[model samples]
Target: DPPLPRDVWLASTEVFLARGSAGSSDGLTLVAKGGHNGEHHNHNDVGSFLVAVDGVPVIVDAGRPTYTAATFGPDRYDIWTMQSAWHNVPVVRGRTQPAGRDATARGATAEIGDDASTFTADLAAAYPDAGLDHWRRRARLDRVAGRVEIDDAWRFADDAPTGDDTLLHLLVAGDVRLETGGARVIPEGGARPVRLRWPEDVAATAEVRHLDDPMLTEVWGGHLTRLALPLASRTQLQVTVELDTPIEDSP
Candidate 1:
């Protein structure tokens, strides 16, 4: 309440990433993820994310699919939901991600700060079986900009052929609409909608699928929705999911 300052604003640490949060009740929270594909219990998601708005999980993790005795067997990865294609990540060079320690997410780092925070991953090792030479993914939780930004850049091995299917995915319990350049998704609780966009220069198609899995059925009470992108690439690409309703902007 100083006269030198025309206005006074409060500051709070809203980012919860590598650094632990100093508990508060300001009602804003954002988390950045870091992990490799080969981690025994982490599953096949190498570059995925979990986002919440007003404490409501908007972009969710497609958690444990139904179980069978074979689910514990060597063939566990054969389960469709166990693959990377079903998570909030991308598929490289037409290959669904493999499950193994050798298939990994490398050099994962996260930086938390007052203005914004960032998390990055070197995904090259995660796609070795897909003929990849190098792959990197960067994600930013911009508290100032009120959106998360993602940039994925990759290259194929010298002898690798041109691609057929290169794409990304996001799993949700929300309703999704395919639009001109991206998609509009209403969060699971039917609160505000989130707009996920791809650049106009990049060619991408968005579609939602209804799944009738035995496990997803028992959990969510119905078929789940997955947003998929079949992409046309050029060694680099960017996709951004904008939270149309950022907490700071809401009443």
Candidate 2:
């Protein structure tokens, strides 16, 4: 099939997608979303994103669990997949986004450039009680560089959390090996490992999540990896799909 668009900016929904030109095995597809917490089949993930390499989803959304009485109950937010902390979004002071239409992204904008596409939004509204004055997330897809960069600039109403309260999450449909500034995501089915990099100050942790839910396992195989990074304000994260250099399996 023909390659997807080089750049796509859905301004109304604040979602952006970018893919590399055809013919390069190392090309990447990036998807980013910024909206209210109360989306249709909401996930409380206002600034979540995903990355795919060679049609294999490396960074993923994990979708939803099987529907049940508890799925839509008043305590629906109790579900792990429904929380913002479980998605590829930032967690502030150990708090994720709250549910409700009132919890929305603000000052959202998109730009489709020749070489890169960018989507920026203020996610402070979606995460109330985090003492945030503003949480600005900017995701840029650079087709020329075959990478996606996400920059997060945040300001707190009071003193910023000096401890490990500020964190970042990335759910992956692959094996993750934690490294200095990031992790190498080894995709299932023999796809090459993609590199995810972050600032030096951020500490990375990998948790293996075995999918027991049939619905989740069907889409993501038997397991997934969650890369959690304890970070500070004004952090930048990057995902690079390399054309060369194979990553060796860890013993």
Candidate 3:
């Protein structure tokens, strides 16, 4: 018998980036995924993110029901939960990433640290059908600063026509307040709040879509909010979501 190493090793999913655990750092964690849409149990989602704190899910995935005969069949994308529009990603024009292995992200890089982490993925190939020439998403998590930042940069093909057609989606539970250039989301049971700050100079709008499904309402209560970040008037965009810890009252 051989002596075992003190620290256990882990393998990669080849498509995701993460930090902390459900309860680590007082229940704080950050996750970002980049991959092809043709994966098993796949959702047409690339360059998406999930964040949780204090065992509370702030930004999350949508209602996924029990699987049946049709879950894995050709009708997978028919489910709302498995569609790109329902995910936490930017929508280019009125198009969503296609359902194919060739619809993938590229040049993925991650820099992990004790107090900070950064991830970058090129998502242009994921939306070739949209006439996308180049698209990139970068995520930066600052534990000390209690913030998660997302920067999306994209451009259309040289010969393709250009128009401002873009929207960014962020799904959350609990109380929410939508402002002109940003939004505030507080998780249920009164956990820390997440503050979203986007470019105000660009024309933007926010809307909430309330879910009516029984199971979904059991978790998220009413609905989720999607941010329509103006993408037609520019070639690059940046969005930041800051975590605001509740102020404890002194006895």
Candidate 4:
């Protein structure tokens, strides 16, 4: 048999199925069946193939895109795995131009297991003005993936206007046991009324509340509130803490 065309080599799948080009559009369709005769619950065997018309070969399917990208090379082609529902597979598309941008925003069908930061950075580079709040929110959600226990400690500047109720939202994505402890206070008021708003999706396993003495009475007071959130997949834990004291006027 004569050597397959470059396009054929880049676009064809090993699975024996009906493969053909759509003609007008630069897309290929591949139909996979369980057996050679294309019978036996074959409805679940269906999948779509997408190829970018550019000189390079970029393909998307139901599996991981990294495998395709590596096989094709970054210079020659790219692949994306589309999110699917039931037997109908959806191949997500992300703009390959503009260099770097989050694949999710552009409808990336593939998921990055461990390189969330790098992926987010790439998306940011691709779309300079792309608001990263969504990515940031997702990153925070991704952190609580495996174990049931979660321990996070960080300091946030309480610089919001006093008397103006402000809410800090913390979204936890996975199921986890949480323990929170911190100090926050207003220099003027000894202790401001701060409340913890647990995410409706998550369960509050335990909570420990404590108020520490004002560290800097001259500048601003600080108080801390901590709680634990237990959640499951697709479950979100939102903690809304409020600061209810008037911010001291600057001298």
lDDT of each residue in 69-175, candidate 2, tens digit only: 98888988999899887898888887888998888889888887778878888888888888888888887778777677877777788855434688888888877
lDDT of 3: 0.71
lDDT of 4 by residue, 113-231 (tens): 33111011111222223222221111111212211111111111232121211112121111113424322222122333222344454444432222232322122213222223332
> CA lDDT of each candidate?
0.62, 0.78, 0.71, 0.23
Clashes of 1: 0
TM-score of each: 0.77, 0.89, 0.83, 0.19
Query: lDDT tens string, model 1, 51-123?
Result: 5544455566667776787678888887766788877777777777677767766777666576666777778
lDDT (10s digit) by residue, model 3, range 1-251: 33322111122444444444322444445677777788877888888877776557777787575676677887888887888887888777778877889988787777777577777788888777677778889887776676777888877776454476666777766677777677777788667777778877765565677788777888877877665666666777787777766646899
Backbone clash count, each prediction separately = 0, 0, 2, 26
Off by over 4 Å in 2: 1-3, 22-26, 159-161, 232-244, 248-251
Question: Which parts of model 3 are misplaced by more than 4 Å?
Answer: 1-12, 15-28, 159-162, 245-251
Which residue pairs show backbone clashes in model 1?
Answer: none
Best by TM-score: 2
